[model samples]
Target: MDPVYHIPALLNETIQGLAIKPDGVYVDVTFGGGGHSRAILTQMSAAGRNGSGKLYSFDQDADSLRNKIDDNRWHFVHSNFRYLSQWMDYYGEQQIDGLLADLGVSFHHFDEAERGFSFRFDGPLDMRMNQQAGRTAAEIVNTYDEEALARVLYIYGELKNSRAIARKLISARQQRPIDTTGRLAELLSGQKKELTCVFQALRIEVNDELGALREMLVTARDLLRPGGRIAILTYHSLEDRIVKNFLRAGNIEGTIEKDFYGNILTPFRLIEKGLSAGEEEVNRNPRARSAKLRVAEKIG
Candidate 1:
């Protein structure tokens, strides 16, 4: 595994939270650097249940293919995690023992300038996680109407000055297309946080991150066997809130349903509630500071 590709956050905590069953099936939906996936594979025993335990790692980014595992029990699916159910069905897996998703951008993408995931470097404004499909960040910046652009920034980035930023982008593109990361970054000059928000908003828009996340969460809820766990590491509040709500209520809307006894009905029993990394880990890898791991086990 490439250590530089990504340093899995809360690695020990997440693996322990899953409570791996040696003869049970597992899935790693975000196999960025194969760190977590490799860890999961280590816990499974090949001799158990006639060597039936398996792991299916999903990654939409073709770049991740380079880090594929060579283990016979490992299967790499080159597709978005939103298609989790379909792919699981294709593999004849009706129920999974555990599922994991580490939802942060890999260091490789941010460090590589041409990928356009970060504003620290100059490159084309292309932020598609799956480079083969979807509109580039530049296309959204240049083509989205002011209101649409502002909505993306406000909803995804949580930027208070989304309207102003959108207006400025609209005005700037009128002179010439906003095509490169440097040019876009120059136009968005402001407090570092705001600049990060703008770039984050564009990347989320380009990849439909939230929408895909919701779909995958729902599918995972349905596909997990009773007592099976799902562990997710979220980097931002937007995705974190969605995950927290779904795990608590067993639905994306987070509505709690109570029985005649006033007991709440939920498919999952919460295991970890937005647990963050320790200061020691954060000091070692600053990028882990924002990661929150939420784990839940399906109620039998």
Candidate 2:
């Protein structure tokens, strides 16, 4: 099956908010399923761009390239977005007109049980976005010390039962290696609803997702031309919190302040407040229920 990601109705709104210029450049840092990328391409080429405009798309997952559409205007960088600045330098582009990061997991990953991104499936516990990357979720769960495992669960999963889960996992693995996603899930069966939390934590740790995201945000801020806008769509509190604080205060923490004259101090000026999916859209795609879209402009 083709990956079934829920396209947010706010796609047009967020793209429009970017105020795309016909001849200007843009970046889609996460080109999952090419949904948002397709929308951005349409708007960029609406006036017959003739491939003059550029869209630098990034995705570490090679599977993503399989869905890549042929277009001169778009250049897919088969690397992590954490290397955003380096890639732009390689392309000889100094700044961009806008950036869009829809930080959602592709339905392709979840649906492909073999990839092991979902607890619903019984595949090997491999959640590496790029299979070529070292270490899988199974390795982390079965190898990390109890304290470290607890930290991953607590910090990434936000699971109140993190300690319990970690203890259980460590104990269960002593009998036999927790090799498969199903085995791990079964080992923590008491978690039930919290199973999602455990899997999410493992995926985050295995991928170093938050660290990569932080790097991307900083690089994106530096990459934006003066007045360029960025739209970020996040699915969880951890990611949303980072995006929220970064956009509003230009820091991961909300401690940054305006100067004495009440002028804002952030590198990014808020274009609008946070946005969530409307009822109709959420009903259509339950996956969008937790999405939060935030847009900001780089102030010179």
How many collisions per candidate? Answer: 0, 0
lDDT of 1 at 249: 97
Please, what are the lDDT tens digits per residue for candidate 2 over residues 45-151? 86574657888888889988887878778889898888998889999999899999888577788888999988788898899888998799989988999999999
Error (Å) of candidate 1 at residue 101 is: 0.6
Query: What are the candidates' C-alpha RMSDs?
Result: 1.7, 1.7
The 0-to-1 C-alpha lDDT of every candidate, in the order given, reads 0.92, 0.84
Q: Give the TM-scores of the predictions, in the order they appear.
A: 0.97, 0.95
lDDT of 2 at 161: 76
Q: Residue 31 of model 1: what lDDT?
A: 97
Please give the lDDT score for candidate 2: 0.84
| Candidate 1 lDDT by residue in tens digits, 181-209 | 99998887756888899988888889999
